[model samples]
Target: MNAIGKTAIGLVFALLLSPARAADINAGKSRAAACMGCHGSAGVSNSGLFPSLAGQSRTYLEAQLKHFRSGERVNATMNAMAKDLKDEEIQNLAAYYAGLPGKSAGGDAKLAAAGKEKAAMCMGCHGNELRGNGQFPKLAGQHPDYIARQLTDFKSGARKAGPMNPLAQSLSEDDIKALAEYAGSLH
Candidate 1:
C-alpha cells in the first residue's frame, strides 16, 4: 500500500482498538457518601423500593444517570438527585457502585421457588441468569422493593413500554411479588 494510505489505515486501526478508560474507583468511593442514604454504603440497599446498585454495569449506571439528568428518564427523586451532578461526579458514582459486591435475596424459599417457575416468561429478554440484556435492567440480586414498584408501574400504565405493558397487565399482584422474590434470589 502507498505510504499515505498505510498511515491513514494505521490511524483508523488505532482509533478502533483504543481501550475505553474507566473512572477511578477510589475517587468514586470518596465522593459517594451522599449516595449512601439510599443506595447504602456498600451499594446493597436495605429498602426494596430503591434498586440495588451493586454489581451493575458502570456504562448502564452512567447512561441512566445521564438520562435522568437530561430529563429523558423522569423520576422526582432521581431528577433531584441528578440535577447538580457534574459529568465526572456521575462517572465516579457509577464506578463506585459498580465496584461493590451484590447482596443475596433473603425472601421466603417456597415462594421464591414458585416464583422461579413464573420467571420463565422473563428469561426471554432478561437472560436465564436474570442478569438482563441491553436496555433491560438486571433483576438478579436487585432489591425486591424496586422490582415491586416497577411491576406496579407496568401494570398501572405508569411505566410505558409496548412489550412490557402487555406482560405486566397479565400478571396478578401475587404473580408480581413471586417473580420479584425469584429475581432477587437469582444471584
Candidate 2:
C-alpha cells in the first residue's frame, strides 16, 4: 500500500479506538438512580412488568432510549422518563446499564425444551446464544412475561418494531409463551 493509504488506515484505527465521545459511566450511574424504581438497581428488574437491561448492548440501549424520547416507541412511562434527557445522558445511561452483569429468569425444563425448537427462528437476529447483536436486544435472561408482552404487542400491532411486526404476527399465542420460556431461561 502507498504511504498515504497506510497513514489513512492508521488514522481510521485510531479514531475507532479513541474514547472521544465515550459515555461517562459515572454520570450514568447517578442518572440511573431515577430509573431504579422500575428497572431495579443496576438495570436488573425485580418484576415481570419490566425487562432487565444489565449487560445489554450499548447501541441497543441507546437506540431504545432515543426511540422513547422521540415518541417512536409508545410506552407512556418510558416516553415521559426519556423525554427530557440530553443525548449525552442517554449515552451515559446506556453505557452504565451495558456494563452491569445479567441474570437468567430460570424456566421449567419441559417448557424450555419445547420453546427451544421455536426459538430457532430467532437465531438469525438474536444470535445463536440469543445474547443478541449490537442492533438487537438480548433475549437470554429476560423476564418471560415481559418478552411475551412485547411479542404480543408486536403481534397485535400495538408496538411498532420494524421486522418484528410481521414476524410476531406469524406466531401463535402458545409459540410466544414457549419462546419466552426458553429465552428467559438462558443465561
Clash pairs detected, candidate 2: none
Q: What do the candidate models score in CA lDDT, each in turn? A: 0.82, 0.91
Tens-digit per-residue lDDT, 4-53, candidate 2: 99999999999999987879999999999999999989687877899899
Q: What TM-score, over all chains together, does every model reach? A: 0.84, 0.89
- Candidate 2 weakest ten by summed lDDT: 103-112
Per-residue error (Å), model 2, residue 152: 0.7
